[model samples]
Target: MNIEKARFNMIEQQIRPWNVLNQEVLDMLIVVKREDYFPAEQKSLAFFDTELPLPDGSKAMTPKLEARILEELALKKQETVLLIGAGNGYLAALLAYRARHVTVLESSSDLRDLAIGNLANNHVSNVDVVLADAFSFKHTGTYDAIVIAGGLEQVPEQLQKQLNTGGRLLAFVGQLPTLTAQLQTRTSGTDVSTRNLFETVVAPAVGAAPVSHFSL
Candidate 1:
């Protein structure tokens, strides 16, 4: 396949029309070699508007979904981010480019290793991939941005409590057949406002034990 052509088409067709118009987000989608992080058998689907299964039994967000979520987060060059799931590390790579640093929290050791290898191979050094459950992480400090890389009924209070002043948190909430993408901002030390971005269904996030029982 003509990789460049396919990437362009993905940006123009699947992502752009989905309203992911931020130039930086668009550039990251192109600059990050997404195929490198794909499960070998799913490399051909890297740019397609479909989810790819990851090593941990969780699925990577589709190209457009990743783009939309990235755009929603609106990361800054000097910000620090916490990503809840590491589906082969592709999303972390994209986030790392925009943020000063990214800490990817994954539950499965096997998936964590896959992400570590992929990030290292790609020279994405700004990300620290850790094998830890998102629900039980003992976070000591706040982050400028936080992203839940999979579906949950709602953004948990624990994650909400960690949002820094002026930080942003993005998540896909609700059960299957209907999930809403929400962007929440910390206006001050304890004030948060949420804006519903969109609705879509995605696989349960790896290690998101709190919402794993959700059924279709």
Candidate 2:
């Protein structure tokens, strides 16, 4: 398990083939060590093309899916991001590297602590991990971008409303056996455009209770 070699293989084989061709994103993926974000037991899966297990009963998103999400979001260096469901803080660290700042909302206290510690360990100082559930938590501040890192029946409109003008959001929408990764952009006031990225299944969020606002 040559770490650097495995990471290069992950980028060249797993992520690149998925259409994640963004150069800045690829570079950030290399700089931010995903392996460092996982626990010892999950470190082996760091560069694998699958989700790493966390103790909160939720899985970190797969490498390719995460890359694709970042690719689509196209984060600006000065943009602020809101990340829902921080898994071990890996994704938040990635977001922090690309964006000016990131605010993570996590329901699981353990996961929140893990995210805070991991981000600190990784030298990511632009992220704040808050112990809050996205399903019930209220977002008062708007963001330049938003990412829902877990599966949801449908993204609530309230969350969508939290997006600033020209903001982008990436999320895995739908339930088991069928889930689609979609990116939404706030084109204008109260109006959003959506694009379907890919299809995949992931575990539910901390307080997932799906409604029905998605059609892909």
lDDT for each residue of candidate 2 in 34-56, tens digit (9 for 90 to 100): 89988787777799987667886
- The segments of candidate 2 whose C-alpha lies over 4 angstroms from its true place after superposition are 211-216
Q: How many residue pairs of model 1 clash at the backbone?
A: 0
Q: How accurate is candidate 1 locally (lDDT)?
A: 0.86
| Model 2: worst 10 consecutive residues (lDDT sum) | 206-215
Question: Mind sharing the TM-score for model 2?
Answer: 0.93
Quantify all predictions' global Cα lDDT against the true fold. Answer: 0.86, 0.86
Per-residue lDDT tens digits of candidate 1, residues 66-169? 88878988888999999988888888999998889999888889889999999999999999988888887787768999999877877788898888989999
